[model samples]
Target: MKKEKGLQKATDFSGIKTIDDLHQHLKTNPDDADELGEHFITKLNNAYAEKNKTESDYEDLLVALDEWEEKPEAASKIRNTTYEANYLIIGACIHNHIVNNICFPGVTAIQRETGLSRTTIYRHLKLDDFRPYDKLIRGKHELMAKRALEHLYYIGVVDRNAGALKTFIELTGFSKKSSASNINNYIQINNLKITREELDQLPKEITEQIAELISEGLQAKDCDKKMEDMTT
Candidate 1:
């Protein structure tokens, strides 16, 4: 407790590296065991805390790497921590949802799959620029309707491959020559052409994941019923 009274060298020294190092220090210093026990415990606790952070960070990094391999275009995001990786994965989920569906999957759906906090997911969504699917804005913003145009392209209505479409007014109700030109710009910028699929359909992996979530929910319900019976 009295830091100033202790040996200056001992106090100034770097942290105890390992259990063996602590034992060596105790042997050479001949400190009181009861007094030194708390110090060693603190050091060990610090080591454990660092281990948890580094371990989780490595795991998140691996997941991020896998995602980057699949969608190499997103590798430009420059992330270096578990926190950043969480954002990256959430962004991927949002992008995938846009590619696969009419609207972004809600935060809870993303949470069920990613196990990230709602706040983290929401923060990533806030930085989203590709579309308004993840946003709360009610109406279509004409100049910024990239996702809508891409959806049309996928469905063969606004054919990017043929360089064809109905007028922007007939297709989207709001006429903008800029929207059509922007679609071409988007195709050039992202170098992507989404395969056509029914809007109601989900990818095979997502379908399996939904089934697993349902099974887990049913198991949790059974556990709750048993707990209620025990209380009664």
Candidate 2:
């Protein structure tokens, strides 16, 4: 009796609370000890399997998150590019030009200054770098000079106090040109290592246009500074 009591105490310490609970647990309850033990073992195995699967799932999720963090630019293509994005870019460039006094002439002004037609001005706006300018011109039923002017204001091209649309088309002083070492640094940082073969694959006209723009931009460095000095 004392040995049974000690055994009972040990089982109780092991968390087998009651005899009925113990009987149920040990598969020695009344009639189906072996079958009941088998069921209980199966349940224990299932619980362990579920815990391992959960841990594996969590590890996979962490790895996926790490990969995403490592390559944000890869995720960028997941987003669709839209006309609105084009507008914002052009708007920013135009605004910068306006603020710096690199202005394009008006409808008649472009005609007088560049010897380009109003239709040409519209066409110029269609270019990727000038899309925002084009959107301003084409957004409404009316020929809204105000909308174009407002976009310029938003881009910080026109001074609020001056209340005038600065030209977004032209800047001066291009003869003394310098290479943009900064652009090379940028290309390297962005991993945009284009080969000569890739350049050749581009349409000849586009390649020429890109070359001209780069040459013009490098030539026009410090153009606004020269203009400011001339004014002073």
Candidate 3:
């Protein structure tokens, strides 16, 4: 994870009023300001990375801070104290990370982790400025698809006779039409030696059934067993 070059140089912080304001103040005014600034920036960058936030999100936060400056009430609420400011910044970073990057199976998982009521989470999500859940879910699916495709490629390279699509379906336990679409897209995009004909040869009914088992929360092994039973 490379640090953004823009953040390396100290930015004007007189107007911005957030936990980051204190961070910038300390970095530029202290006797060992250079060292302290570097240290603080490193920790801040690490927090962003830990939350799986991209550089774009960091830029968004900066913009949000700028917007906050215009709202005196919000600006006044920002913590100036070092310890409290650090804590709040870290918390917000984690929350942002989860909202933008994590794909929770349900609201309960989110509630357990954030200690926020499901209603509050939903309300925040409804705000246009908040992270887009749909995009996050799509991103998660794309990642899973990529990994599955890579595995298929490896198996194909190692053993030409291996049933890569069937193996991938079994391994990922992804039976949905979307999952199938992702796999097909990856196959086409990479122009991998594997053929659509090969994938199409697998029984569509079994694939769809596997997806149904997945939606029912069946484990991969159980789904495999169900698939086997269906075939035999």
Candidate 4:
């Protein structure tokens, strides 16, 4: 009987031969940068698969990459033509934790690993830009805020009487004044439960005074009744 053939495994381009070869390949196949990025991601996943990489490792990488990218020598090496190479470097840097900036490497570490100067790495980072990745982070914070607000509403932590503006301020770390202004605008735009008039009626000073009094052990029921009478 004929011997059965084994399945062929994908070729690992991980062992790139030379810098020139890498430059040429990236120059020739610009679109392939995305594929190279995926390859780098796979490499990272495999590397961290067995042992969990610490937060410091990821942070160090970001700092290293940040420093490396600013070098003039780095820019001149990849200058103008190799989008694939640029994308590959960035993809590797931000692979698993795109939303987490801590995953980025510092310049010295990146240089040590890639054998490239800081400038070259810097150029690569700026090539396609990481703004889209940054947006992912901002989007995450926004989602969290939304969920927190939903929870507050569900558990009666916030209600028509106790507006979500305070919770939004606490969760978002925005100042009470700014948070109120922003929440007012948001409520107006979305036509949410709170109205502009209601928000305007309770000035920041009065709300703060009420909060202070409540914190001082004043009866909340009496305070609420007083606030209602004052507003009316």
Candidate 5:
């Protein structure tokens, strides 16, 4: 594991895009999650030794690890990778599925559906499973999945995935042209203070221009002006 710490530090290269590049870099360094966990254990031992603190905390951590190893589910999860990294991959899978298939579900829904703890899901979305150390302390993963969806939305890959099931919040507003005839029908049906006789008394050209404007999404004022000029 100590060897892994060296590998982790040495392999961190910036500006690399795509997973293949990452795989190549990692292959050269060859560090795994076991090494990462062992490295953290060593650090914890050093800190406790320096402070001359009670070893009970370290002992408890050891016991926790032992228990986790015995648990079939946890053991399988951490088989070839670190607990954190595996958790991250799971979260990404969950996120992709939710966005692509089911409507964007909130954290509660995600938790209920995936049966993963909220903390783990948050950590995956926010800090990529707390790899770099500082991120673990920063509390950045709070609502991380939600933030990722928002990023996707701004990029136009996904629409509003919230508020109503099966209905995305429309940014373009109601279709004015599509509804104009319905609106006119409603106004006519209501018969508020005006009668068919009054509508009939209006000039035929004015009525025709109003109909055209309503159907074509043109402003009534512009339609009226155009009709008047045509007559002149």
Candidate 6:
């Protein structure tokens, strides 16, 4: 029970938008690094999954913005603060750019693409820690579980829509199939080595799932452990 409280406390990375914020946090509670990093990974993963949801790039962001203006309370897709929304949106841009593009686009390009000023992009992205920069006020874990489904598409185990399914799984625990049984039924498995930088092309949540699956069939190295080892 006490652990849950500490965890809940640790999850609050609201103000941590910059690497300097992370540095200050480390100075005070150096021990929380692992937990902090885990939260960071979770945040990025959530944002990435959010990025994947829309078939098109920043178009949905504009739609979400319109919804917010009409009814802030009903803007389920947008974040609370302007900064928070920008952060998530920028994270979406970053996640989208890095994975989808062969060449990395500069912040200036990101500004043009998302209609966000370069300053806004810099602020939320200055992260050097695990503090979550949330865009969605609710449904974090359910969102993250969806990332695991992306592996199905990556590995050719399922169609592209597979990644959209994890919202139904409880992050607390789910009685899904074994890691191996989940993917062996398919052909042309994408190499899911956790150590490969390509794995970073996927969100940490999906990477972790891939690691678990690959670990069983082949003597895959403890790459997934490395991926989950947020302390470092």
| Winner by TM-score | 4
Error of 1 at 205 (Å): 53
Q: Which stretches of candidate 2 lie over 4 Å from their true place?
A: 1-191, 228-232
Kindly give the stretch of ten consecutive residues in candidate 3 with the minimal lDDT sum.
Answer: 74-83
lDDT of 1 at 229: 100
Clashing pairs in 3: 175-211
Better of 2 and 4 by TM-score: 4
TM-scores of the candidates in the order shown: 0.22, 0.17, 0.26, 0.31, 0.21, 0.26
Tens digits of lDDT, candidate 1, 1-232: 7656755553522444444554565566654344444443454344334432222322333334334345433323322233355555676877887788868789887876566655556555675532323222322344357677756545433222222233322344323333444343221116654222321155656534533454456567768999999999
Which is superior by lDDT, 2 or 4?
A: 4
lDDT of each: 0.46, 0.39, 0.46, 0.47, 0.44, 0.49
What does the lDDT come to for candidate 4? 0.47
Report the lDDT tens digits of candidate 2 across residue range 1-232.
4554344321122343233444454443333333433443443344334432222222222233323345443222211122333334345545665677778434454334333334334444656644433343365524465566556544433222211212221111111231343232211216566543454466856644654554455446657778889999
For model 6, how many clashes? 0
Candidate 4 local lDDT, 1-232, one digit each (tens): 9999999676456554344444566665655554554554454344334323222232233233323435544333222223344345546755634455555666666655554445555655574553333433455678987787767644433233334434543454333344554633323235445444554577887655544443333346657888999999
Over 4 Å off, model 5: 1-80, 92-96, 99-103, 133-232
- Quick one: RMSD of model 5? 20.1
Tens-place lDDT per residue, model 6, 58-107, is 32333233443365453333333444556567778777888888667787
